[model samples]
Target: MKYPSTSTRSAIAALLCCTSLVPGQTAAQDAVQLPDIILDSGAVADDQTIVAEAISAGGKLTGDILDIPASVSVVTSAEIERRNAKDIEEVLNYTAGVVTNSYGADDRFDYFSIRGFNAYTYRDGLTLGENFGGIREEPFAFERVEVFKGANSAVFGVSDPGGSVNYVTKTPRGARFGSAYGTIGSFDTKEVGLDFGDVLNADGSLSYRFTGLVRDGEREYPFSRNDEVFVMGGLSWQPTERTELTFVLDHLDRDDVPGSGGFPIGYDFDRSDTFFGEPDFNFRGTERTTATLIGRHDFGNGLSFGGTARFSDGNDDFGYAYVSGQTATDANRSFFASDSAEKVAIADVHLAYDPQFGSFASSTLLGFEASRSESSNKRYFGPAPSVSIDDPVYTGAPSSVPLFADGETEVSGRAVYLQETLDWNDRVIASFGVRQDWIDITERDLLAGSSATNDISATTGRFGLTYKATTDLSLFASYAQSVVPAGTGVEPENGEQFEIGAKWRPLGGGTLLSAAAYDLSKTNITRTNPVTNLPEPIGEIRVRGIDLEAKAELGAFDLTASYSYIDPEITENGTAGNEGNQPARVPNHIGSIWANYTLEGDGARGDMTFGLGARYSGSYFFDDANVAGESDSYVAIDAAYTYALSDNTELAINATNLFDEKHVAFGGFYADFYSPGREVQATIRRSW
Candidate 1:
């Protein structure tokens, strides 16, 4: 893909040429840290470092060190490797203000919430909304993960301030080498992976990397198994110093034997209990497949472009067998049998410009994106004429019933956006942006010949300002708006957010701290009954919260801590009085802390490192009505130790959930599951 040309580049070059009029001036003397600038793919300036670059490079982006007006967190690759994080949920659990939930025995159908807003997974800055069936991400291919908290409407156009996550992928760097690792963990889990990369010539012109991983494991529940394999490869060509190109391909195949539905909250907060209708119900197994392709090009000018295409195919055939005492059904009764499939495609283009007009410096960005996704759900129910408890025999005939209707739904979206930032004297900055989007949804029932379609168009805007109060402190504020179109009978809602904060670094670059207060409100929410087709006031919601974070490096020790407080309320709703009820699943308090110490040695048995971390979350309402709630307040501890066994080999042991806190991580009336309890793994790696 290619980006359209603009005058910003030529303008910058002309200005640079005219600078010669100044006598006794040198290029080095004139070069300054360009403010409010955006560069194309590989054109990022050496002096300008963004949070995204920090993530992709396995480094830290301390709040006090960067001038970004919002709260941004980085999850480095070293941390992921230390924790042996196998998936996005595992990696994010340690992050502040993030929560995840999984249904049934499948980890592929997980849901995520960040800062009280639903922030689904994304790849290369594009949302992958087709995950309902089999669309999922493999963490091994990612270099790092970045989380931007608070409103992101200015950069992404339509995003909740609750937060947004971006996964940065690994790229080939024209080197020839190979590495391998093997791990054994709890539940008889065993995994092995190999990563190999090579350069075709000495001119640094052609290179490629191939990676593959295979895993087999069993869960803590009965009849549940995890088996998966992933493979990926990429090719790069750098024909000239000013031009570079890359193509990447990846594939994933997974199979899992269904366990019972996730563990449910018992009357007494039991993490081991399954609260569904039956215990012996069988849920069969599932199979999932995914493929992806990505392309990127960078021109040395202040501009670059990239694109990605992906397809996923999955099949899930599971039987939900339940026993009903009210109907006097047989002990072995299956209530639901279903299979599902989905497909998705996404395309994007990016542009950036940096120019100086006298003392005023500005950065401009323009982008366009389009995506299409489709999904189908087919279900079959067994026949049972037993309408009452007196007819137990009729319910025993499993094959007597007819087929049920098959349900299918398709959704697609297209969007375009523009954003610009203006800076003054490295002390003040302002940004503005706007976006427009169009979406369509369609649903059909095969048996009933019933169909429905919904279309929506919306626009959003963002504004932000930052002022340096002193050399050690900065003040910032922003306002942004977003929209989430409803599916089925629901109407779209608009979300508005305002944030004000200050960042302080008392010890200059050694220690960093930040505190922010924000308010988020949503309007035009839809509450509609699918069966009745009646519209009701869904009401508005407001979330007020404060976030605090600190990071410091002293000697050989690294320490980090963060805390967040939320008071989400339903300001207006038809079903419930506007008496400030807390939003469902949003905890009032959350916090996390981690510390790592490194030990250096001069001998062949080189260095060693030890790390410890813990996370805590407060109580939350499980239901929308707030009648029933879950006190998820619990502390989880993790410890890791790594040692270099040789010059090219290492060994490590990691233990997570050290306390075995049997607390509920996430739950709902429809599904409930406990967080994974105490798991330990040991790994051995060799590199060349």
Candidate 2:
């Protein structure tokens, strides 16, 4: 038998003892100082943003939205809670230049696209892809969601040129407060959540927060379910006025049915209420754990440095019985099972200097980032008996499972970058940045007894200029470049974007309006290499779009409106037939408007608020060939009403797709994915 070492036991003992310390003691009185802390995780507090007019999406440096040359959207926690969003997809359903639910109502992932390409997910300014053991991000775990449009690889490192979404998680706070909520909704969904925060020391430095939620729910589809549990704990310590450290631990478990297989094309049945797959054996389960640590120290003299480190691990087990082809009516059913384990570690450090050089004010940043990930998967399959579409039989199929395939993959990346921003008399702003990344990938085909490794390097850059046209308006233009790694030996896909825009503070205090137009293109698309007979870059795609956004707070009304137009086409395709075709599932137009009004009630009624919103998405091609079919355009209606029971309590009801609009949200590889129907929920919340 083996036990913990003396040093390990000592550390554990010390941590246990700290929990027993009296809260009234100060650092001077006790040998150990609890440390002062700042919540909000080093991000600009929600209160500091004037009705979404200020943002930090372009760079980690917080600044006025007008100063950023790219289009950005900021969704605050207040708005998220008001709408009773259940997932990240729901939170972005109304944001501009985004298409949520691209895979319909699947819960296995937060799948979506920004502009015409996929958007990378980030937490606390760090990428959460394979580099960080990607998991389906829950909206409730975050305080805000910021969407940055266009390529940001110069600052963020390898990213989708369309954009990125940053989720700022909640943090501990100086003030002692707690809140709890209970919610019930359509589709047999029940949820309970708790959020508590408190200062741990008398000096007002050490603070901690514990937040968690347990939800049980069933999807609208037959034999489908969505249930999960999540917990997050955070601690912030400021040992000195100039130095601080924040740590967060998060865990999630998805124990119920995870995803649904879409129906066959032209099924002619209600998409939501039909079941074509096995009910007893079909399931998807996942468990993920993540830890993040952030530290910063101000060195004075206009110089500062900080670092962020994260580790994540997860396991996913899924089985599905799905369609095998597009032309099949009811004869091409298949059954498969896959089990995967993934682990990732990533870290980054940055130094910044804010100073005046001659007549120009400059803020310069230098940073380096690195990440490594390992993943393994085993898959099994068996012959599945076909079932009649009209008269489905639930009781028959092959029982033996045969190993289909197995493999392991390891990926590592390192990047160094520098960014500089200069302002001339606070009238003209110029920004430039460049980054170089080295990536290595290794894959082992266990079943085939083959292993391959590849190493690649790329450098990207970005430049922008912003002119202060007026005190409340700015005109800006930017050019950015990025590289997306395809595979080993496959030349990385390269993208470039050119954008011009204008931003205006319409009301001078609580309102903002912005409009942007951009032309973006990606080339070096991978194809089969003639020499190695492996995939290599030799394709191209182009996307152009215009976006308009407005957010404002007026006397008793809060309003948000957005409109987008995206035109995307495959300029070069390995398959000659796909050239000039519109990319699959890329919508042409999307628009939305949401408005809320608050009214003070008469003495007995309490205050009441009502909100109404409408979202529209234009129809688009569902396949690369544009021949199978096209998804139908539809409008979804959302409504909300909240009544304040007291100063610290409220009751609310929120509904989406109020009119029950039914249409295809996207087309899958073998079938068409339909949109979810109307869903309504009610919540009761209390805070201290």
**1-688 in candidate 2: lDDT tens per residue?**
1233354345334433433442422232332322323234443355233256566432354577778777889888777887777878788877889987656665666777888888887887777862122567878788789888998888777777888888887878666765668788887777777766778899978999877777667777777766767889999998788988889999887765655566676666675567777787678888999998988899998899888888999999888777555433363567888889999999888898989877789999898889999999999987666766666676544475688889999999999989888999778999999999999999998999999888989999999999988878999999999788887767788988999999898646578888999999989877776777788666788999999988887878988899999999998887556888998878999999999998988777889999999999898887777886788888999999999987667999999989988776766457666787889999998665
Write down the RMSD of all candidates, one decimal each: 12.1, 6.8
How close to the true structure is residue 342 of candidate 2, measured as C-alpha lDDT?
Answer: 91
Report lDDT per candidate.
0.63, 0.78
Question: TM-score of model 1 relative to the true fold?
Answer: 0.81
Task: Give the clashing pairs for model 2.
Answer: 35-205, 36-205, 36-238, 37-205
Over 4 Å off in model 1, which ranges?
Answer: 1-65, 101-108, 130-134, 157-161, 257-259, 262-334, 380-405, 469-474, 488-490, 504-512, 530-537, 576-579, 664-672
Q: Tens digits of per-residue lDDT for model 1 on 1-688?
A: 1111243234333333433322222433442322323333332221122122222211111122346667666665555776777777777765666755422234545456677877745665666542344345677887667777765544554455577777766667576555568788877787777666667788879988776677767665554556666767778888876555666677665655444444323422233333332333344445444455555455544565555555555556655443322222222334656677767776666565667777787777677777787778777776322232222232232443345868788878788878777879768888777888888889897778988888878888888788987777888888887776666566677787888888776655545677888898877666775667655547787888888877666777767788888888888887556457777778888888878787987785578978898878787877667875564677789888889877567898888888776655545443345666787889997655
Model 2 spans > 4 angstroms off: 1-44, 47-50, 57-61, 130-134, 325-331, 357-359, 396-400, 527-533
